[model samples]
Target: MSSTLYAAGRAARQSGDLQGLIDAVPYARFLGIRSAAPESSALLQLPFREGLVGNPALPAIHGGVTAAFMENAALLCLLLRLDVLRMPKSVDFAIDYLRSGRPLTLYADAEISRVGSRVAHVSVRCWQDQVQQPIALARGHFLLEPAPESA
Candidate 1:
């Protein structure tokens, strides 16, 4: 993480603000990803825009954008739950496109499947209208910063 992002992350940690963290990431800002208020559920939203449409015929959000959104959700989840200053790096991510993503405000929530000493596993589900009917699902592995050892 750059010094600016590090500082932003630290400030967000202290104040429980997600926008600072999100704004620090350039790609997140370009994609227009935003989180619900901290008091609300940990749901990330990708608002609809003409630029995000991949297929004019289908009028669907690009597959890459969908995948990136899920990955962002997972990363943000880890950041919120982990006790580290530096952001985690993605090891690998696998995604399943269940259906064509309609050009609408998409929402995603990530579940932390497991957290080991240096690795965290996360799964994300994305939907527009119904949670039960997800448009995509993704699982990602992340490399976390090592925990400091006590003397």
Candidate 2:
């Protein structure tokens, strides 16, 4: 599975196919995750679906779903931006729920703070209508496997 994903990642990177990369991940497809503007930025988007509602009364998105979306944003950013050959593994993730996620399309952007030899630190913010009013924020570390040098 990892090898397949690695090959897909390499293919996507070589062709600059952001949607293809998202399609390579089953879970991302299940969540309706897509690139907001792959040609410009690493912004990720999740279309609102009835199944995504956690609170029917309040019509709010599930917390777990929101977290997973943000995590995916970070992971996608790493895959799109870095020279990684193997899949990036989450080391630690911390999220702050600023507000309940409304039953609307969610947008997320991940910024890589630093990249060490083995780990990369990333921060992500999820919002609905307004970017200034974020619904959730997260910071995480991912274990990276750099591509081996050519002889």
Candidate 3:
């Protein structure tokens, strides 16, 4: 994992806003992310396949895909808090890889650092089998402007 994955997190730490980076999620995943408690943490699991693989020889999961997993996991915090009724959009996100993700099911964890009036922030971490070591980390920000009520 490259150290850059922690980019937003590091910045947020400096700015005292770890929650924004903790909330971004990818555009993939057939099943949405989940949380044990409304305020605990967001968790996501994605199975590896050629669809997620960029190169067949390396069989390494694409960095973008890994980022996506993190993003989905991070954004899940708000969804859980909102009870899946409100849909949040991905305004921006940042990822830092700690190492290369191997071919396997990935588990992602995210913590909400802050959920302000208009912005929800989160931090995400990814790992395969070992929870002790993280393969990548990410930070994301989501805008919470409600959409118009269509008749």
After superposition on all C-alphas, the RMSD of every candidate to the true structure, in Å, is: 2.4, 1.8, 11.4
* Candidate ordering by lDDT (highest first): 2, 1, 3
Cand. 3 TM to true fold: 0.66
Model 2 pairs in collision: none
- Tens-digit lDDT track for model 2 on 1-151? 6666666677667776677777777888889998787563678899999999999999899999999999999988888778777679999999999999998999999999999999999999999999999999999999999876750
Top lDDT hit: 2
Decoy 1 TM-score against native: 0.88
Candidate 1 per-residue C-alpha lDDT over 76-134 given as tens digits, one digit per residue, 9 for 90 to 100: 77776666556789999999999999989999999999999889999999999998999
Of models 2 and 3, which has the larger lDDT? 2
Ranking by TM-score: 2, 1, 3
Runs of candidate 1 with Cα error greater than 4 angstroms are 146-151
lDDT per residue (tens digit) for residues 25-87 in model 3:
233324333332222335556766667777678878888888867876765555544322245
Which segments of candidate 3 are over 4 A away from where they belong? 1-41, 83-85, 146-151
Determine which window of 10 residues in candidate 3 has minimal summed lDDT: 1-10
What's each prediction's TM-score? 0.88, 0.91, 0.66
